[model samples]
Target: MSINLQKGQKIDLTKGSGGLSRIMVGLGWDEAQPAPQQSSGGFFGLFKSHSQQQIQDIDCDASAILLNANGKLYGREANDCCVYFGNLTHKSGAIRHQGDNLTGAGEGDDEQIMVDLNRVPADVAKIVFVVNIYDANVRGQHFGMIQNAFIRLVNLENNAEICKFNLSENYYGMTGMVVGEIYRYNREWKFNAIGQPVKEASRLQLLLNMYA
Candidate 1:
């Protein structure tokens, strides 16, 4: 019973049921197919047409930013609070990011992040999941060249999908996206579908500054 969430929708992850101890956050995306370039061959009849050569894989990197009770990062200097490709797991061991081209998870998920809700620290209030294109500026790439981008939450115990958020809007100039957030609410964990795009950012660090 998976629910397709709309942007800005919020849902309870652990409620009524005893509590969800483990869950997986899966993200997926594909490079938009370039238009078929069927140029009419002139006198020489030489034509170069279509796909692979034009659209290279857009390296979309996803990261989780851990925020404290006040919804703020530890500090601008405390970089260890963030878990990304460089830092696969947090010191608390509550969150583990399976990043770095680990697309074998299937179901079109390019990357996945596992969370032990029960192990999260008390002071930590939220885990913001963000995705950005690596070296987008240098590569001249943006979300506009991306397609089928989505984020989903799965209950590991039964392999049931809790909810999914699809970023189906036009992101012509966006280089980054704020996919979603998992935060504590009255001692319970909840998920917020924040499918918002960020402009002019070519790296994940810039998106983090939103909280700092």
Candidate 2:
């Protein structure tokens, strides 16, 4: 089925076919800043002043996506500011290996986590993806804006768009979190946007609750 997403909306994938035992988790964002550098010192300031140096923006576009597939959780750096895929084991969580390209230029950045339905463990029920903004606070500087970020599930068997979550905007430079579930009855994957604009602390708590 085609997945429809609204700004700041959540979708759950666990209700889907029990067939989806494994899946991938992906994360991506846009970088809207230019490179930064230090400025020359004045005659009165013999040494370069730390205050005069420009701090680089925290680019969330280049962060590693974290997930819990089976009993074990896994993480891997994104290839670009786009799509990535990982193998999910029900017990271990996710086994991420290769990354994909979902830059979202004109087409949009589309990152994904692939799950093999047959490999899921009985105790494991869902998958979570936490979108992290790389270097959020550096030299007391904050990352500016993060918009139009999201996560989705692609059915490897039929090549269908099963579930999705949309994170259209975040004002506080906080991270984004989305959760997906693999249902045992219908054999279909379900997804939901759990928290919009969630901070690092909240995200960590959620992950701990789910995995721990």
Candidate 3:
């Protein structure tokens, strides 16, 4: 069955009646050309330099991407941003990982985190992805301006969509996080309410407790 989703809404999976086995998480968006900040100046009066890179037409066929379990989240400009893995950690701190994509261009330009159901930690009830637009706020860079972004879950065994979450609109600060619940029932794996991007990682813990 196709999962229904709307931007800025969250779904609670703990209330679902069953458990899910293999879940595939995917991230997608409409690709838009990035505008150049300014034009280049040259000594030659006859020379005119283009300020922005040519934008490509949105590819309807590349709207979805399957995340690899070993994949890592990355920023469009790696030097300008940082990606962290946040969850229930023993150290109670975010673990930073090398970004996988830097240029926010073409298809599959966003970062993705994958979870293998069989390898999930026994104590881990959920996982979250945190995007730090800039290591410091002074730079004035953030992800709030991002558009047409979404997360999806796929059933690996059958290559089907189990659920999806949208992140197109929100008033939350630039620093944001999205979480998905893990549950088991009837010897099968199922996920629920995998929607809405949360502003805090701790909220994931709260949702897990609420549904567990």
Candidate 4:
């Protein structure tokens, strides 16, 4: 059975039940139904007025960063410590992002990142998972228009779900979220569910700045 974690909760991932090396982090979300469009005196508003425009799809980018023991970026360059759509795999081969999901339109996990716990360097201590709205400000999109956001961890060996955290907090104006963390604790790997919202510009830079 999979464990459902609440915000601020923590759980052991490798302290017992043998050692785990391969894992998958799954992040899923759905765009909220669009609000009813105002009628411009047409049949079912089939023809939108020139001033009215359809809502653009929400593009939530899921990314991860490796942090040192002090909770800071471990790599010399930003790309060295982070993995996202542009950089699919890390140089160490310990982490990889499957791909980018242009729209949060499907069911289940919209994005996934694979992690080899054993392959991660000793210097790295924590892996933080985050999601942010791409070009949110200019596109007029935010987490408020998002629904059913969640993050989960699965054992790739057998495809068994370990734990899941649902982001149920009100994030109307928030543009970025620090969803969770996987870190070393007591010589074992553990997960921390963090549903903190970031009201900043919803950019990866805003998240990296937290580590800096």
Candidate 5:
């Protein structure tokens, strides 16, 4: 069974299992339904004006950053060590991003990042998970419009879910969210649910602020 975690809660990654070496972090969300359009009628309100503009999908990008014990990023470049759409894998080959999902459509995990716990370097302490809208401010979109936002960690060995966290709170006017974090605790791995919001223009800026 999977464990559902609450905000600010933390759980051991290998509570009862020690052979777990590979894990997957999955993030998923749904595009908000468009609001009802207003009618501009003419000729005794017989005909209503309509727009030809097409509705775009919500492009929420998922990213991960490997930070050290001092809360600092190992690589200075954005794509060098950070794993995301542009840079799919880390230099050490410990972490890798599956791919970019242009739309938050269909069901299940829209994006996934695989982590080899044993492959990760000793200097790397934490893995921070983040999600942000592609062109939020310019397109007038935010987390308030998204629904069913969630992040989960699964054990790849047995295909069993370890824990999951869902953002159920209202986050109006927020462009990005630091969904969760996986860090080392006394030589054991643990996860923290941090549904914190950010207003940065891009994911790079948000990460800089996080490690700064």
Candidate 6:
């Protein structure tokens, strides 16, 4: 059985079981269905159904922000350490993004990041996972329109489930979320569930807040 994580929960990545070297971080979500509109009709019109608009294809991107012990980002050669669709792999070959999903339509993981725990640089102390709509403001999208959002860490070595976090809160005006973080603690890596929502214009602004 996997550990079901709640907000503010923390787990040591390298403890309990044997040493964990490789792991996959998977994030998933589905576009929420809009509620039906109500139209006034006859005396029995209360149960009448109004036309429902098709749900727009909202694009949600997953990104990994690699930071050093000082909580600062080092630019990757291609994508400048902000590993995402634009930049799939880091210079160190430690963290690599699977790809981008234009819409959260289907099932399973919409985006995934593979982390070779042993390959991570010594100076690099943290990896922050963030999910944000590509053009939230322009598209008028928010987390409120997202459903079944979750993040899970799996042991790639044997495909054993480590931990999983389901974002069970309703966010109405927030465009992005700092889903979680894996940081170095006592020389061992640990995962923290931080489902903090931010209404930033872009992902860059959210990164700045982590440093601030």
Best by lDDT: 4
Location of the lowest summed lDDT over 10 successive residues in candidate 6 = 40-49
Q: Evaluate model 4: give its TM-score.
A: 0.93
Model 6: residues with Cα > 4 Å off, grouped in runs: 38-55, 75-78, 201-212
Q: Is candidate 2 or candidate 3 better by TM-score?
A: 2
Off by over 4 Å in 3: 7-20, 29-99, 136-138, 179-212
lDDT of 1 by residue, 1-212 (tens): 99999999999999875668899999898876565445643211222333224434568888889998887885344445688898898887988998687322334788889999998888889999999888888867788887889999999998899999999999987899999999989999999999989996787779877887
The digit string of per-residue lDDT tens for model 3 on 1-212 reads: 75666544444432352444445455555433344334463221112356333422222111111112222212223221222333212222222232334334556425544445555433333344333332313322234434566667665567666667665555234333333333444433444343344343222233222222
Q: In model 5, which range of ten residues has the least summed lDDT? A: 39-48
Name the candidate, 1 or 2, with the larger lDDT value.
1
Residue runs of model 2 more than 4 Å from their true location after superposition: 6-26, 33-94, 97-111, 139-144, 176-189, 201-212
lDDT of 2 at 8: 42
Native-to-model Cα distance after best TM-score fit, residue 42 in candidate 3, in Å: 21
* Winner by lDDT between candidate 4 and candidate 1: 4
lDDT of 2 by residue, 71-131 (tens): 3443332221112233222233333434434332333444444555455444334444554
lDDT of 4 by residue, 66-177 (tens): 8999999988998788999989999999999999999988899999999999999999999999999999887767888889999999999999999999998889888999
By lDDT rank, best first, the candidates go 4, 5, 1, 6, 2, 3
lDDT of each: 0.82, 0.42, 0.38, 0.89, 0.83, 0.82
Clashes of each: 0, 48, 12, 0, 0, 2
Clashes of 5: 0
Output the lDDT of residue 205, model 3.
31
Task: At residue 130, give the lDDT of candidate 6.
Answer: 92
| lDDT comparing candidate 6 with the true structure | 0.82
Q: Over the stretch 74-135, how does candidate 5's per-residue lDDT look in tens digits? A: 66677644788888998888899999999989899999999999888888899999999888
